[model samples]
Target: MRSNLLPILTALGLLSLSQAFAPDPEPRWWKGNTHTHTLWSDGNALPEYAVTWYKDRGYHFLALTDHNILQESETWFPVATAGGARLQPDQVKAVLESKNPLLEERTREGQREVRLNRHTELVQRFSEPGKFLLVPGEEVTSSWRSPGPEGRGHPVHINAIGLEAFIPPARGTSVVDVLNQVFDAIAAQEKSQGSSVFGHLNHPNFGWGVSWEDMARIRAGIFFEVFNGHTGTADAGNENHPGTDEMWDRANILRLTELKLPLLRGISTDDTHHYHGGKVAGPGRGWIVVRAKSLDLDSLTQAMRAGDFYSSSGVDLQDLKVTPTSYSLQAKVREGEALTIEFVGARKGDAPEPVVFSTSQGAEASYTFQGDELFVRARVTSNLPHPAPKVEGETQRAWTQPVLPGR
Candidate 1:
């Protein structure tokens, strides 16, 4: 009996040693664009071509977030206006050439001319294992009244990532009601599928329509675009409503500290529609670099859910850490330009009223939270080209991972 017990104990000790020696999981960075359009809806480039554009540009992941459609079924348009919106002459030629083989087969059977791959098919074809990935997504394009009674509907775009199918736009009597409906739909999807499908209010300042009140009352909204790459979407500047970044901080301060709602974070995206003949069609204007355990969709979404990403127009951060005690960030700069980092936060008793603490620029910086501070967030900027520039004025801006209340 003693001999048998001794052998069992030795085996157990060996098992424990094996477990201890196993390697820790590796950390990875996945660069992704959450909002994008393709020929399936209003975008100018074909889905296949757009996929190539991102994959070729070193983007590890992309989402084809067309408006209100999932690129599932096949559709067609006239040869002259095959893909809606504007198309450069070369874009037209590239599309037609790619479809020439299919056209020849159709011609032999006395059928009509020209066809392109369905958006889903194109994405599936282009996506490869561990190299590049295409995650299914969509923008629930809706509208709201600006001011006047029966005010003209202003466009409001919302990106839904990791969705299984298309979500129809919420039809309602008011913008607030519409937003609530959309939010509810997203929540339902998350509950039913047990999948990570994050939804964000896109570009509140795009039309100067969405307000602090609008964001304050949103119950299910977890994120809103702090920056968007497109014409007329204001990320900076002090015009009435706060800049998207300021709005994020003020809203979080009020909601979490004052109103006791869950805190929300900022997201940056290239809400790209034009893909031909302009600066808007260019890529790398805005993106989010997410730190995840793996490059898969689940891991990426998990990180996003935890606010483990930074929005960027340019500027990459070397390290970012957020904890209950303090918030810190560091930026890696380009050769010629200097870098600056700012730690921004609001205390619980610091008056729901907004205030700017410091506006100095430097290579590195930190802010101490005093009194009843609700949470803290940071922004890092550099003299680099805007990663996604829809217009001339918007330039490079980098935002750090948000550190929320109650750790």
Candidate 2:
């Protein structure tokens, strides 16, 4: 009788995937930072300390993406090292304060070394069912250069999120080739594991490495850093070069009109390495707020893939809605904080530059699509300065994913 009623309920429009057996679910926005470094790589803090930092600060999830290494193995680092990345005196105090039982010490070469907490250990210590989560990830660090006198070297880094194991850097003949190779490897891993794994292109202008043309040419890129908190990332362009924002727009235009590929969404990441204050790279600079059903890896990544997320430096968004006919969002701000919402996108013609479709000023804004756009995205800005500015004169901002009209 129950099986016979299922088709009748479905035909009556009462049964669906989300409401077939239970009431429709309400999704919540989860804050997370996808890029971070710790003692597992060149970061100047312990893994436990880093996890504590985010958890205590109300971050829902974090990915400790060390360079080419996952925090899965038993590794040890000397408390005080001569050079390279080492924990400071204060960080050591915090590490000890946690009283992690996994903490162990040993004597090697007449110097005492402390065991670096593994990812599993951090999960056991830090992960709360609904409060906080530690997502396993790695930064697939790789580089390439042209072969000649004028051959400039470029660092091509990609962040792989939700990894069960380390992904070796896939080398290729050129920059585009390298991006494609790494993307393919990520896909292969997702296939092998039979789970959700996401990849994003790191800072493109780190070494002036990836050009906008290279970004436009990539066929498999899902996302790229439009705003990175680390110094020397070059999010803003100089007199000669285009910034990452412009690069994103241009790449999207080309991908939508010429390359016939999916437009890459923008991501904001801390890429934080410095734990102590006073350094350029630190936590709380940038992150993504994702709308998902639950605070888990698969749900978050799925929402991110579906573009149900926004990247923010300091500004927060509420009631964000993206539909076929319209795109709208409301800014969550403090007292007297001014807001500006710009609908920026490219049209369907041959004009290359992206223009502002509409601009709204105040706490909330919405724009109705005329259905002739290649893609339209929102850029929300607040007059309040970033508490932890990535660069001088940086203001609080949030960016929504681009919507392709008539797609």
Candidate 3:
């Protein structure tokens, strides 16, 4: 019996040795939405109510990025109607219906009003050890009129996730100056507070605002929303402008090849403002799955900083494997649905537009990085319609973070 088992032991030893040298990922994937709103600025619902929505929906982390302000200060907002503009009464009504008990409401000078919940209260209430978390965030809503040839008042709105304080938008003669100001302010915060946070450019094509060249030139603007659920924001390209995917490729090529800078990471966000009805700007439309050790702000932000996350509109990836030589993904598919995994990347010299290097059907797909390939990333698409699709004929999709050459 001992002689017969000797060969099996040798084979087992070889298998163990090979695995020790192979790529092994240890962090767990924690789901979260870094862009969202509460009634502190433009969102309709109370912070408590909005947080409850995400927590109930199984979100592991969330950042309530109200425009131009943080929820840290105590303030009261009068009940206002949407008027097809910003916050509407209907959103407040939805909050009232929740019977949250924490909704602080009172009549100020005979005006119906609700006091915004403090971010501190939320961290105390919702933050669980390994279950759920609240990330402090703010939307730096800055804009500047382009020198023509570009669009109108180009919104340089940036979303800062888990920052220590509010970052006001910086305006400049050009897009680059404004962006630099915002990033510099964030850097200052990190240095002074000894804290960490991440920033992402919001809706690059909202008004044909940011030029493709501008996207490439803003080197410190390390992240941007590739897919935003706002209806007015054009996700697809028109006759003149490139679509989000097209813009991403163009900017990245310039950054990685010419600028010799770090590649920009892509994020999908709900940017939910109108919470009521089946409106376009609502939650559950988009979010990110972060590979991290715990559901804490530091852990998630660190993982995101490392580009150890993927954005999804509806699809959830069970496993994502990225190594120096290859990249791969696996999805938990529903019955009767189909998946098409496309390996999208480019080659060296006169960096060609990203094309599908490989394609496959079913749940799992992978792409081996050829020596010539500049970078390789997987786009997993399923036949299932996006839960909160902005346009018709939209299917659920997941974009793995790009794996660059030899890294």
Candidate 4:
């Protein structure tokens, strides 16, 4: 009924929201990092360091998602404990040596260090009109011990993007149990606050945690990390575990076929911790290009939930178009680099729906739906290697969002 009503509303020039699947006001792609960390958790740098790192590298937006913690209050952390007092020797050295303006030196309780700015304060300072933004978020690092040493268990991290409040990780014995609770908390927060929020399951292959079956059953888990930049978090699957790409296809197939759920959207992020060096799993390693009405947080999040974005690691999209049945895309190709655009999706009776529909060796590519397929999406691969490769032959790539039956 909702699908049938869209054409009527669009024709009558009434409110045509999702049925329209229309682009936002003056739509343009805004680049951002959705999963990230700072000194708030196990990250090695300050929150502002992460924020500025992305902004300087041409990102339009950012979400500082530290584990189970939001940057809400003023707190001082010891960087290099010495002289029996709190100290940030590395941060101080960097600040003084480089003379970065964002760094603030302060004396608190007879300890000298760089002052860590709260999320509220940094948002005010970093937000620029139509240029940069910081979307407040937190990573709910859930755990379910299933036989690891010291009771330390496999990790199930979910990032609640555009969150208005903090959500503690849901604890359970099964990964699916924890995932459902985390998603419910995100939903409940939006319900109570009268605001909007969207979240995605973090790297499935990280620590060899989360499987195709683990993600397939969670009706609320509509997004996951198809690509992550952190080297420790393996994106590719081995013989024993399903790689992120495999998990993505399998989960989508089971969800769309058996459960009749919504299509899962793919996202990428640096998951960066080290900020001082170029070789680290740092900012600019991965990002999402979101086509939205504006560069503000609200518009970006709205576009993201609607899958109006593509994940990329060092690949830039030149243009994209989608109808109910087909998708067209063009990638920005660098000189001396070869490009291959592959269309992938699931057909009837396939456990995983992704079968290659077309392969083009150029900057532009397109694919029309065969109509019998569950959904169709595209992946653009380039011969250009990453400036810092996570694994061997980890060339540059971009993932377009899936196009479903009516969208």
Quote each prediction's TM-score: 0.84, 0.92, 0.87, 0.87
For residue 230, give model 1's deviation from the true position in Å. Answer: 0.3
Q: Pick the candidate with the highest TM-score.
A: 2
RMSD of each: 5.0, 4.3, 8.0, 6.8
Best-to-worst TM-score order: 2, 3, 4, 1
Off by over 4 Å in 4: 1-24, 79-90, 93-104, 108-110, 147-152, 278-280, 350-353
lDDT of each model, Cα atoms only? Answer: 0.72, 0.86, 0.80, 0.81
Q: What's the TM for model 4?
A: 0.87
Give the alpha carbon lDDT tens digit for every residue of 1-407 in model 2.
36678878888887874466775468999999999999899888788888888988999999999999989787878777644446655567666777554567788988878889888888988899888999889999989888999997889899998889789986789999998888888888888998888899999999898998898886655799998989768888767778888889999988878888887899999998988876578998999999999899889888988889999988899779987788889988789899999999888886767889999898789888897788999999999998766467989899999988655
**Candidate 3's residue-wise lDDT over 150-196, tens digit each?**
55787888888768777877879887778768877877787777777
Q: What does the lDDT read for residue 148 in candidate 3?
A: 58
Which 10-residue window of candidate 3 scores lowest in summed lDDT? 14-23
**Residue lDDT tens for model 1, 222-323:** 788888887567666355767887788777776876567777778877777776647654556788988887777888888887888888888777777765
Clash numbers, per candidate: 5, 0, 1, 4
